[model samples]
Target: MLNLNQDPQIILWALTKDTYWHPDDHWQAVDRRCKELSTGEIFAVIDDIVHHFVHAPVVILTGKNVWQREDFDQILGKMAPILPSAIALNNPRLSHAALLSRWKDLGLTSVYLRLQNPRTLHGRQTVALAEAVVDHGMRLEIMTAVTPRTLPWLPGLADLMLSVGAASWQLGFNESLQRSKLDAKTLEQTLVWVADFAATSPLRVLPIGAPQYQRIVSDRYPLLDAGRIALREARGIAYINHHGLVYPGVNLPFAGGNLRQSSFSNIYRESPTFCALRDPRPLEGRCGFCDYHLTCGGSRTRAFRETGKLYAEDPGCWNPQTA
Candidate 1:
């Protein structure tokens, strides 16, 4: 079940790990919260992230599942050469061999399907869904959001996902911005349960969009001192929302610059807000004093949300000394 107030020191790498995909959701909008990107803007942002050392070539494309434009394949054709590893999140409505063959032709290495529909993950369709991904020779990563309602079922869900041949399962904790949040105690317990359960499971269980827990990710999460605030969210796992508003992540609403006017690299490297986040001088509390501040500065987003300070102590951390 749930472990209470577990020692975070012994299991830093067991929980957090490096994210292989750079989430570029706003690139192409599908609905109200989604934003569309031009062909020029797409390449421009990719160039920016790589040049700025903010991210690698691999990117996570989230937004509209369906790419209706005929030119969509053309755009991917251009990026395929530069991006060797690209993961697209798609709906699991169709799992036929023909659809799988089509996805393989699109230069996609992985297809992330959300297991939100209880019927999909738990129903008889589970086996078929897993077979479609595996038979297609594409890595399958299943994602599901963890909310107050879903907390208790997470452990069982992870097991079921693995049973279906899911290569990885991403448990996304609900965001306060979405009118949902799990308390620190409950969150820690949940993580402990996951880490313990997945420690032996063949399946890879990862926190959705979180890099702060990299230390606990076994041997997977790199221990590079790459400036967590900038690398993980701001620069590394940067978020460019619809309307071209750029931030380190959603937690910090301050826009670095609009993608419409300034280039992504220029905005990422030159923006005062972004630059300050990369700088380690102003970090406060344990993050400021620790040697791991550059690489493990807790979560700037969480700090901003809880303390309203760019460099404050992370509320999720009970003993900064353990870090």
Candidate 2:
């Protein structure tokens, strides 16, 4: 069930810094170093979220290669009782059915596969892993970055994910590693295409760091009925990096507070970062003048990346007339 009351519903936790497949040189928003938190540290974060937040958030376990750690299964076993969680991995070893069965036994509701290089042999393994995840009665999600190289494959990719019984497919832009080659018109066209695709397909298409998608799609679909994909940063989502630092969203790098120092609930309710992100009135330029500012304030991460201001207009937003 999706939490529709504006309380936090999703929390992304960077479980480890060790990556097994490829580095996020072309996609990550902030550069993360090699640092792995101890099981105690992980448990403390989980407990804070459980005790502080108004509701139990669906914790999404993330890392470059979370499965690289030998004790990860043990860690998951301990964390499951506190809150429901899902795991994301980039390992080809996930194609094995036994491993998926083990994760199912561990009480994971879903499994996310980060398909970075979907044009290579790793892509094939990801497909196999997706099938195995569904076969084992666990939900499967495919997450990939939208780059110049990957853009052309999206239509086909959507078809592939649908064929494999994937529950959702998330597409996000490259924020820091490299400047995006895609322009405003290009992005708008892409979102329009996705909007059209989503209306008829059963598979959910989610866009990260591109909240403008909501405004674009709202022209055709009812905004309230658009599902959780319409939700934006600080509205019902938060991110915790490997160091236990909390942020408004996955791509938004501004930190509210550190779990090691303060309670998650206090920071979430009182921090300037969280407060600013939640209230769209402070946005400047086009974002402030747009009619959909309250519900779809253009991506704050993209604004920061392009203009060095968190509240600046999204450079990729192609909306001509301002409200």
Candidate 3:
């Protein structure tokens, strides 16, 4: 029984300061990029973009600097009022007990916690964390770098499994990037390992990795396809973070070309999930071919950058070249 009225699930994964090339420029960039839109538009853009990718019922915000919880909260507070329904919190920084407490206070529906460090914890300590999560009525999503054999050692734990970064390549790729990485067989074996342990336990086993690996999974394993998986298995969800230009309808950006044109309005509408930062009316009568025409408020930034207008063709649009 799927709940149609429920808001779509989204996951906003911000890069860590170290990983972000222009850490100091983020706030300014965000403001500049979204300046043309209103609060509603911002929410719509984010919602649409996320919905386009994974139609999950839960959204998770990842890659926050938990060490600066106060700073993180401050930034989130500013964004929260607009995206009130969003469950915004630092990534798996708090202890299990602290996490439970925060989840309750924040009215969070789900949380993604990193379990990488716990592999070194004593058996008792690990058990305590696991027990606290289950007992506290908190959904435990585990992100770890440990091998499959060690997962069962923390039995009756981990309702959701997430593999991050390099560890993901270990899960599998359509084509191995390097010989050191795990092949499809190894990845399937590992998933089977976790699936066997969770056996009808209502636990979801997901391998969260790079876009390439995610695409491979989505293509190979039906269960790994976010939309299809969510529709079939009511248990858990999967998300793929890929970088691609979206256009109205099936108009993709020029393939294998550097000069791709896109329209601001089309991108917003094509985005599976996004938040609109402005009103939708300004884009009417623009981009005539856009099937989502009237409602497809163009992307202001993309439009201006490409054509110096708020309702022009996206410089990334590839329909002409393809035709």
Best by lDDT: 2
Using alpha carbons, what is the TM-score of model 3?
0.42
Every candidate's CA RMSD? 8.9, 4.0, 13.3
In model 3, the Cα lDDT at residue 286 comes to 31
lDDT, candidate 3, 122-195, per-residue tens: 43454455456556665655545434444344343342232121111112111111222443345544445544
Candidate lDDT scores, in order, read: 0.56, 0.74, 0.34
TM-score of 1: 0.70
Model 2 stretches astray by more than 4 angstroms: 1-6, 18-36, 68-71, 91-98, 116-119, 176-178, 223-229
259 Cα displacement, candidate 1 (Å): 3.3
Q: Best by TM-score, which number?
A: 2
Ranking by lDDT: 2, 1, 3
Estimate TM-scores for all models: 0.70, 0.85, 0.42
Cα shift from native, residue 41, model 3 (Å) = 8.8
Which is the winner by lDDT between candidate 2 and candidate 3? 2
> Between 1 and 3, whose lDDT is larger?
1
**Across residues 99-212, which tens digit of lDDT does each residue of candidate 1 receive?**
666656877676676675455444345446666888778888887777787777776777678666788887776433233477655666666677667667888777743444
Residue 199, model 3: Cα distance from true site in angstroms: 4.9
By TM-score, how accurate is candidate 2?
0.85
Superposed model 3: Cα runs more than 4 Å off = 1-10, 15-56, 66-102, 117-119, 122-130, 146-180, 194-199, 209-323
